[model samples]
Target: MKIGIIGGGSIGLLFSCYLSENHQVTLYCRTINQVNMINQCGITLQKKDSSILSNIHAKLSTERVADELVLVTVKQYHLPELLPILDKIPQHIPLLFLQNGMGHLDYLQKMKHDNILLGVVEHGALKISLSTVKHTGFGTTRVAAYKGDMQKLMAIKNTLQMSNFPFEIEANYNEMLIRKLVVNAAINPLTALLRIKNGDLLSNNYYFELLKEVFQEIIQVLCLQELEDTYFASIVSICQSTSNNYSSMLKDILEHRQTEIEGIVGVLRNKAEIQKQSVPFLQFLYTSIKGMEYKRWDE
Candidate 1:
């Protein structure tokens, strides 16, 4: 199987290294410097005890995407810029989106492709450099077909699944994405704001309370109370499992890079407006994270 992974970030690199082990993988990088580095040195996947180097083809994202299956791993904010590039791809090729929010669904609906799959990545990865990524945590990837034939998608899923990096097919795309969105909305901003790791949310009483409040507001806005216990447990379990790892949003802030606040919290804000409900806590976190981005830009 030939796989083309868009975005050379942590998730993209991580997927590239694993998929390359069993299939032909091509990593699309935003810059030529990244392409050159990966081509020269290959990509390094670092684990706690050891590291594995995988040789994968690297190319600029501007080039054509002709692979059989493509994984779009870029941040939600970067989606708009890639519209032109995605438009050029053949519709028969399947495109799988691995993002942190549900906001991308709206954009995906407007695309011409018929084979679109959405994936929720539970694994935690950190990009150590242009050609290196550290797999901070191991988790399964849940995938659901958004606009494609289920049988075809299942075939793709079967080929992509491995013991180390498991991929499961979800029954509903909306449910899967919403569950992930709520978890991200409750966790990422708070972590980014407090400048704390995932564990702190549970270890600190005050933060845990705030997390519950935020979760309540989100469920109210989305009418997700019936699954409250399920979502809450999922969030708590993620924090406990990845306690020592800094969230992607926090890492972005620390590196003075733009965070995905709009995708995570901004999506909820839009829904709250539609339902004519005020999510004060959610709004606060949104503004607070946006302010931090402003500060990053100013400095």
Candidate 2:
């Protein structure tokens, strides 16, 4: 199978290396420097057990991607600019999303084609440099056929599984998405607000209290969505498991890059307004992150 990875960040690059071993893989990016490096040398993938200098086809545009399966790994905030380019990709080919938040469904539903699969990847990787990627931890990726034909998607899933990728099929997708949302709302905001790594949030009571409050707000919303409270504990477990990881938001803030704050927290705040409830904690986080982002721009 020929697979096109849209975002050439750490996770996308890592998957490209792994998938390229047995399949035709292309790492697509927007930067000329990145394309030059991959073309000059190769993608340096440092795995837990071993390392490899995998040769991957790199491109700067989707003009060359004809009938390959595409994986959208770009940040949530960039989806609007990224999704419309699918017209260049063939309509019958499958496209899977490896994103970090909810709300993609509505945008995807607006597309002309429905060959979309929603994927939740748990694998963690750190992009140390432009040419280097370190596979930090292990986790399973969950995939489900959202609005598309399942033939190509199932083939992709089976191929990944046979290639020793750690992943599973989520039985209940709404529940899975909601559960992931609560976890992101709980951990991501606190880490971004405190300017701390994901693990450090657990040691700070002030941050933990803030997270608990956010979780409570999310629980109320989840209850309205008819989800049970048992999913609440999973939020705490996510923090504990990925405690040492740098959340995408925190990473963005530290590097002075744009964050998915609006996509993740802003979405919740919008929903809160619609529900006629005041989410003080989420509101505070949204304001704080936005303020910091503005201050950086001013400087």
Candidate 3:
């Protein structure tokens, strides 16, 4: 299959590394430096055990855009900009949204990209350099087609599994997405605020309390999505699974870059307002981290 990855970050390039072995992989990069590096030397994938794999195609922009599948891994704020770029790509080609929070589907809905599939992946990777990425943890991916296209979803699932990637197809896409959002909402912000790794939250009891408060608000917001069953236990399970890793939010803050507070916390706040539900904890988190993001600009 010819695959195109829309984001040039860790997640995009890491998948390209392994999947490129059997398929034609093209990466869409925004920067000239990344484009130059990939064109010159390809991507380098470093394993947890220090093994290295390199050489994968990375394109500067979308040119000759015929792809059987496309993975949109751009940040939520970039969605508006990214969608129009995807217009050149074929309509029937399946697009998988690999983002960290809720409301991605709603935006896609407005743009009318109904061929979209939502997938929640737990695998973690960090870009150490421009074209170098380190795979930190291996976690299962759960995906489903939101537009009632079961056959195509199954085909994508089969290919992912055959590629030796850990993945599964959830019978219910909405429920699965809400569950993933809940976990991300619970863990990401506190880690970013405290400037700590995922596991470090376990070391600080105060942070655990903060996590519980956020998880409760997430649970409250998820109730609007008919996901009352996504409880604290589910959030705890994700915390334990990704214990040793630094969250994407923390990575953003440490690198002095913009964080996905909107995707992670702002979405929760938006849901609460739309549903006329009171989510004080979520509102507070949204305001706090947003302040941090701006404050970093002064620093």
Candidate 4:
């Protein structure tokens, strides 16, 4: 199978390394420096005790995408710019979007592709360098057909699944993405602001209180009243599972890069406004994170 990963970030690099083991991978990088480094040195996947380098074809994202399957691994904010590039792909080729937040669903609805699949990456991946990624947590990639055939998705899943990296088929895309949205909205902002590891949200009693408070606001906005326990429990489980892992948002703040707060929390904020509800917690988080982002830019 030939796979075109459309982002050279942590998720893109991690997926490229693992998927390249059993398939042909063409990684689309945002910069020429990364492309040159990857094409010259190959991509390095770092684990607890082992590191392996896998050779993958690298190119700028401006190039055409002519692969069997394309994984859109860019951040949600970056998706708008890539939509034009995505439109150029042959309609028969399947496109899988692996991004946080339910906001991308809006863009997905406007797309013209024949087979569009959605996925949530649970693996904790951190890009160590332009050509190296650290797999901090081993987790499944849940995939569902948004407007495609199930057999096609299943076939893609079967070919992509490996021992180290796994993929699961989901029946409902909405249910799949919203569960991830709940996790992102509840955990990411608090951790970024508090400057703590994922586990700290659970370990510290006071932080745990704020976590619950934020979770309540998110569920209320999304109207997940009946399954609140199920979703909340999943957040706690994720925190424990990736206890030491720093969230992507926190890493973005620390690295002075733009975070995906708008894609994740901003979606909820918009929904809250539409529903005419008050979400002080989400509002504060959205503003505070944006402030930090501006501070970095202004400095």
Candidate 5:
């Protein structure tokens, strides 16, 4: 199997390193510097006490992609720029999108690909340099078929899965994405706003209470009944498990980069308005993050 990853960030590097072990992998970087670095020295992946270097092909995003499976690991905000490139690829090829929020769904639906798989990555990864990534936390990846055949999805999963990195098939795409969205809504903005680690939300009673309130508001907006108990537990468990890691949103704010607030909270806000429901907390977080972005822009 030949895998092509379309991002130079942590997730892209992580997937390229692991997938290259069993498959021929090509990493498409946005810049020539990253491509040169990876092609010249390979990719260095660090986890806990160990570091591994894996040699793989690297190319610029402007180059044509000709792999059996292409993984779109770019951020939700970067999707618009990527759509044109994706459009040029043949529709028969399988494309897996690993975005964080729900906002990209509508755009993805309009794409030309007949085989599209939606995936939620639970592992925590941080980019140390252009060609290096640190795997801070380990977790399974849940993938659901959006418009692809089950057999093809299974074959793609089998070729990608490994002993250290596990993959599971989800029956429903929307459910799988919503479950991840709920977790993101409850944890990401708060951590980004407060400039704290994931553990801080659980360590402080006040923050924990706020997290619960946010979770409740999201459940109400989405009307996810009978599963509220399970979803709430999942949120708490994720915070506890990835305690020391800084969320992707928090990292974005700290680095003065754009966030996926629209995809995560903005989608919920739109749904709430359509249902004529009030989600004051969700609105607050959405505005706060937007304000932060505005401030960064002004500076």
Candidate 6:
């Protein structure tokens, strides 16, 4: 299997290293330095107990993406610029998009790919360097086809799944993404603002109160009222599992990078307005994270 990964961020590098073990993997990087470094040094995955390094092909983003499968791991904001390049890939090849929120869903409608898959990466990964990623949490990659054959998704899962790194195919893409969106909406902004690890939200009652408030608004906007309990439990489980890890949003704030607030919270607020639902908590989080991101420009 030939797999090409777009973006050299933590999630991209993590998948490149793990998938390269079984497939002919090529990592497409935006910067020449990362491509050069990955080609010379290989990609490394640092686990709690051990570190595994895998050698794989590296290429610049400008090159053609011809592969059995391609994973777009770049942040949602970067997707607009990337879509033109991805348009060149043969539509028959499956492309899996792993983004934080539902904003990327709109992008899929325009793609010509016959087999477009949507997925949420539950595992927590932190980039240590250009060629290294730390696996901060262990979780499954749940995938659902936006518009494709189920057998194709299952086949891709079977080809890509590993004992240590697992992949599961879901029946409903919207449900899978909604669950992840709830997790991100509740956990990310709280952690980013408080400058605390995810676990802190669960440990502190006051923080937990605010978390519930935010989660309720998101659920309301998405109209997941029936599964509120189930979704909240999933959020708690994720925070508990990735206790020590800083969320991608929190990391973005700390590192002075733009967070995916627009994709995650921003999208929710838009939905709220359309539905004529009141979501003060979501509105607050959307603006708050935006304010934090705006500071980057001042610095």
For each candidate in turn, the TM-score is 0.98, 0.92, 0.92, 0.98, 0.98, 0.97
Which residue runs does candidate 2 get wrong by more than 4 Å? 150-152, 224-229
The deviation in Å at residue 287 for candidate 4 is 0.7
- Tens-digit lDDT string for candidate 6 (107-196): 889999899999899787999999999988788999998999999999999999999999999999998988888888899988998899
Clashes of each: 0, 1, 0, 0, 0, 0
How many angstroms is residue 27 displaced in model 3 relative to the true structure, after the best TM-score fit?
1.0
For all predictions, the C-alpha RMSD in Å is 0.9, 2.1, 2.2, 0.9, 1.0, 1.1
- For model 5, residues 189-276, the per-residue Cα lDDT tens digits are 9999999999999999999989988988999999996799999888888898889888889999999999989999999999999999
Query: Please, what are the lDDT tens digits per residue for candidate 2 over residues 76-151?
Result: 7777777657766767778888777676766877766657788887788888776678888777788887876566
Winner on lDDT between 3 and 4 is 4
Candidate 1 lDDT over residue span 56-122, tens digit each: 8999999999899999999898999998999999999999999988778878978998799999998
lDDT at 188, model 5: 95
**What is the overall TM-score of model 1 with all chains considered together?**
0.98
lDDT of each: 0.93, 0.76, 0.78, 0.94, 0.93, 0.91
Candidate 4 residue spans exceeding 4 A from truth: none
What is the lDDT for 288 in model 3? 79
Q: What lDDT score is found at residue 110 in candidate 1?
A: 88
The digit string of per-residue lDDT tens for model 4 on 1-299 reads 88999999999999999999889999999999999999999999999899999999999999999899999999989999999999999999999999999878889888888899999998889899999999888889999999978899999999998977989999999999999999999999999999999999999999999999999999999999999999989999999988888888999999999999998999999999999999998999999999999999999
